[model samples]
Target: MDTIGHHYIVEAAGCDPNVIGDANKIREIFLEAAKRGNMEVKASYFFKFSPMGVSGVVIVAESHISVHTWPEKGYAALDVYTCGENADPEKAVDYILEQFKAQYAHVSEIKRGIEEEDRTFTHTILTWEERLDRRNGKP
Candidate 1:
């Protein structure tokens, strides 16, 4: 079996308008979501825009979580990417939606991996050539 990477995209609509413009609140939401997903957040940064918006990224060991909020539109877009066992990006998405009191959310999940048969002789030949060149000190 091939190793796989999981990625998630989450969009929330009809979120509380007040929450969108606050950088501190947005940070709280992200931290809470990371905790709920059992993800370790190493660092984060957020910026607040006047007239109502916030944007931020949380650096997590598994990968990262990012969000942008629009208060006027009552909408938020989020991306959660993780590449290892015990990382559930879906849970993080759910936590954010619930925290923002979103009326509805759109979620997408994609699994990334090379198909077994798709890794044919051509791929192997290229890999072998690269290895041989590296071993022979041929740039």
Candidate 2:
């Protein structure tokens, strides 16, 4: 189907708190993820919270990748959106999860700006979960 963009909404759990709490590391991770996903990075910024947490965004030519973290809960929320044909949001998401060492993740993908025959626009959503630490064939 033809659409304007792909947006990935992700919830990652069982991650390393330290990794997610570090703003500098997250900025680095996001930049690398943009490269890994074949995205053209225009600019980026990240902020670290007192106590424990972080928030950040990487703006790309196609769209952007953003994240928020709760270190105390070992959880993170991420959004990867892109409209360019050359951009791979999935690859970027995967890299982010791997870098955070997430043991489990729930991902929802939305096909945005779906134009109908009547010139209307709509979106489609698909959701799934991954058990990244499936040791001994068990999640």
Candidate 3:
């Protein structure tokens, strides 16, 4: 298999507006989620917008989890990307929704790092003729 990563796009709605705007709460929720998902949380940072929103990212050994919340709309958008097969991104999403008490959430999953089989680029693989051409200084 060419894929090496798993990515999840989450659309959360009907969340607790006040909790979504709290940077500290958001960070706490993400940290717990990372732990639950088996991701190593190395560092985290968050910024609270003046009008009422929070944006934060949790950097993990596998990859990262980010959240952008719009409290006024009772919504949050999240992206969870992790390398290797052991990490469970869905667990993280579920925890986030639970933390915010989200009434509804739509999640879309995609496998990353997939290479097409139709063609092979020289950078990836080269035939004997191509190697010889390189040695001969021919394009």
TM-score of each model, in listed order: 0.76, 0.92, 0.79
- Which digits, one per residue and each the tens of the lDDT, describe model 1 over residues 68-97? 899888788878877678777778876777
Sort by TM-score, top down from the best: 2, 3, 1
Evaluate model 3: give its lDDT. Answer: 0.77
Model 2 reaches what TM-score against the true structure? 0.92
lDDT of each: 0.72, 0.89, 0.77
Runs in model 2 with CA error above 4 Å?
1-3, 134-139
Backbone clash numbers for all candidates listed: 0, 0, 0
Q: Write the per-residue lDDT of candidate 2 for residues 10-56, one digit (tens) a residue.
A: 99988888789999999999999999999999999898888879999
Top lDDT prediction, candidate number: 2
Best by TM-score: 2
Residue pairs whose backbone atoms clash in candidate 3 = none
Clashing pairs in 2: none
